[model samples]
Target: MAIDPKYLMESYANPIDYWELFSKSGLSKFPPCVVSVAITGGNQGKESNPNLPETLDEQVQQTYDAYKEGASLVHIHCRCPHDPSTVTDDPEVYRELNRRIRKKCPDIIINNTVIGGKWSRNGVMCPPMNVSIPARPEVGSVDITNYTWSMMRKGRPEYGRPQDTLEEMQYTINKQELEHTLSEMKKYGVKPEFELFDIGDLQYLRDLIQEGKTDPNVPNWVQMVFTPALTYQTPDMLLAAIRHMPKNTVLGIVATGGCQYPFLALALILGCNVRVGMEDGYYVEKGVLAESNAQLVAKIVRIAKELGRPIATPAQAREILGLGAPRMEF
Candidate 1:
């Protein structure tokens, strides 16, 4: 049969019919992209924003309000009730906060933090503590056969440490710490949102999965947090990091300070989810501090809508993110 020029022109001019047909036949439903509101980070002080929730009661109330406003997920970092400057690694605190939020908004996904504040050389907030141990016999054996192995398995096996002489190894939270945190979250049916500050963090997550530390059915959501002072927090850099992310992993962008909104905008445009709040950036605009976490989320929602993107609701987000039953009844 001879190809018709007129037919070719028609196909080119109106591809919508073909696209819709293809979409219906092959594409799974595109879950509405979720917008997570990070109510409070562990680092920021009350001086930064009086509206920032510091105490457990304040954190719970703020998280509940955000969920009511339209946040499907609340990214949380528990601060010491007595000291905002200190980051608590206590699973008890996380459990309490998680319980409170679940009671308030049953369907809202609670994302707990694994990476605490950056510890200083004197064990303060600057250089994070280093935790390294020899890979288990199985991990080492698997490295020999696994095609995906990338770390130096033979060298002085350092797990989570900055490669610097001046870097002092502070208190290292081991597998016990991880188990404790995971156990608490499991109690409330809350999902952990891992924060990968560097490639090492990504490797650690893979290890967790391999060691059966994390459940496969549980949706593995990760945030690629970029620190401009420590690492390049640019669009290209963020994209490069995403390229290496594991499959079935949902990613959110979290760039500190000036690069925060810009990276978030990039994430939204790229059809990925995002996290924004006082934890990532204090300012809603240049030189203007955000009054609340809701304000930040509202701003992102506005931008997403303007770009013709729909914000994911709690149920829709759960489906998209592959979460199990909601922790509490809605």
Candidate 2:
């Protein structure tokens, strides 16, 4: 369906739809928007995007650049020191990564993923949901539920080894593991960024809170992270999820493919923060791939500014997330 000249001319009437949404939603008065750059995903490496960092030095340097480009916090997923593409669940790996990143850019708030990695082993795809970091990250992710993706890793070199013709993959967020992971985070003073892919994940979290396992007094980083298997991907779906979410929390939106860019503005309009990078999306434009994580971050900063929302500093982000001071020096 080609958008002809006539259609284009008609579009000018409401050319900037985001403005209309913001004005109608009364989201003009927005909190400082925090931009979190996921430097690397536990499942992907240089194969997906050569610019994706594979070494500790690369990750730290890339993250430092992203910090300079207005990124307040960084979401980290470590790659193997030996292979640079493999994901490891070892606590030492997490500790070393945290230490190196801290030594380089001490001011950027650091977040660690609970997921170590997922790969096919012995003809079975193991979900790396069972993990605990000894490094004691300032914040960690807590994912809920799992979905089956038919096209998970078929001929998708980006998903895994291109040579392996993989089948259906079940990326489950093991409840038992999640409970343990959350307990560890609490033990180490790490706040969890509860990541919900479906609406049901909310009730699961509430149950945990009621059990006195979690503290509602602290502002939870409630993340509405989307997957390809998600039944709902529309803005209205997000709105509905937001309604069900606990009021005492900070909202963030993360989407894959090319949807990350649109969500950046939509989140701001709804008074939500944003997660952007090669992990969430690889493209800065329709065909242009981002050269670095900072490039993707800089793009969102511009969009937030255009909407009259200022970017939050590291200190502001810490306040928004109810986090302590920066753990290291820059």
Candidate 3:
């Protein structure tokens, strides 16, 4: 059988497409890696890791430290001012935080979470989902699939419950929420950092793109979230996930808890970007809690340097991700 000339040429469309070339040419040809740090997440707070930043001042300072250490992007989850344990829905909180982060790290890409804490009982999505875009993030994380999740954790004092008591949340992110999220992101020019937990999420996002629901010109920024509950983090699963992504996708990898380091290293070696920080995991190593988000950023920087992959600066990251100037200035 004769091979087609069209199949013989190299066409770099997505991160995974580099696999064959990388095998033959080696790491010298790899592009600069974008390191995004989730300084704080909506879930977990000082209780989980005493050093985790839950206040405005702490978050800003931690983010600045990470930025200085080579993190080109930061994922933000602003905590309620009054109750520092729970995540806030108030756009003011988000806006204020973004403004401060901008002042400290002027060029770093600002990303806000779309999913916020629900009333511990009902599963309806609230607050930040509607307000994240209004707060004007350059990127908004949207979980593209609909799923139900239930988890129990130590109750926070702010929840009016005993610290030892286990509080549970059984929530669902459905189609209605997904549609609302996509619409808001489109309106604000916020790039959708689609969080893919499973292969179905990838398929759903591809359908959205095919149906013209997503902006074709904008790069599909995907973060493959690996966790015990969502998608099992394994080398084969990671490879399969990347292989199924649509062309023109910019891939980022993140894993919860213990899987963090190995997957992050794998992401770099595979020519994909990476996301780190306290949001994904609070530890710098096994049983060793990271004192600050910057510590994790510094560790990843060291890994990238060791692998001969240069870390992208904010300007370089913006260009690599095809993002324009800040959508809305504070």
Candidate 4:
């Protein structure tokens, strides 16, 4: 049998044309929209806000409530009950929490955090192991710095007050730890949302992809965080970081304090996603407290709708994140 000339020549044509054709044919619409709820972060204890849940039970309840409100995905950071201030890297902690969350709300997608804890020596860091692949190009690099106020005590205790010292401390991730954490993440089958604090982190991800640890077809969501104390996370910063992102990846913005609205709006406008919760910002607006994760999700839903963008359902979001459809058993 003779092969068709058009089909043979098509292989040499631009990939962009193929993508345009696929998009025009409506194959793109099948992937539902995504709404990720950042449930409980590692930082911000009960002292910061009594509403923040510390234990697994409380975290599960909070996640269930957010799902009810409209969150299809939940970003989780497991905490140690013995020390509310610390973040635990133990897989059991994450598995237990995942189990509870699955039992309560099986349909919601669960995203686990590889970035954990505030180390006096290392500050804030990435997963212990570096996991990246050639096709994906963004999974194995460590571009973020871990810094905390606790480091200030090293020098002049008097000059290094609680707020001042915590704001200035910083640390970097080593290769061994990065590999270990990525291995654990894969073992759990929990999707990871790479948290990038600066443009350097983006470069690290790119290197990881080149090294062959990340999967290109999978939706690797990268979050750009702007904290209140240190540097400002501007719109330009987001654009710069994502300028070189691979086709299968998605970008999200997380503002630590009052900049959530600005960055959230920017993310949506830039054709990216947005994450909001007590973990990112406590205030719904200036001087107003967000009562729950649902309240924050509602606000994002309203914003997306007003901008003519639709909010994604849990099932749809699962497909986008490359997760299996909600299993009642899980």
Query: Among these predicted structures, which one has the highest TM-score?
Result: 3
- lDDT (C-alpha, whole model) for all candidates: 0.58, 0.71, 0.77, 0.60
Q: What ranking of all candidate models by lDDT puts the best one first?
A: 3, 2, 4, 1
Please give each candidate's TM-score.
0.68, 0.84, 0.89, 0.74
Ten consecutive residues with minimal summed lDDT in candidate 4? Answer: 130-139
Q: Give each model's clash number.
A: 4, 0, 0, 31
Write the number of the candidate with greater TM-score, choosing between 1 and 3.
3
- Of candidate 3, the 10-residue stretch with the lowest lDDT total is 1-10
Task: Supply the TM-score for candidate 1.
Answer: 0.68
In angstroms, how far off is 184's CA in candidate 3? 1.8
Quality of model 3 by C-alpha lDDT = 0.77
Candidate 3: where is the Cα deviation over 4 Å? 1-20, 23-25, 116-128, 150-152, 165-168
Give candidates' CA RMSD values in order: 12.2, 8.9, 4.9, 8.0
> How accurate locally is residue 330 in candidate 3, as Cα lDDT from 0 to 100?
79
Q: Can you write out model 2's per-residue Cα lDDT over 82-111, one digit (the tens) per residue? A: 556566667677778788878777777888
Model 3 lDDT per residue over 240-310, tens place: 88777776677888888687888888878877889999989999999999999999999999998887777
Against the hidden true structure, what lDDT does model 2 obtain? 0.71
Select the stronger candidate by lDDT from 2 and 3.
3
Over the stretch 253-295, how does candidate 1's per-residue lDDT look in tens digits?
Answer: 6777776776777766554677777777778899888777788
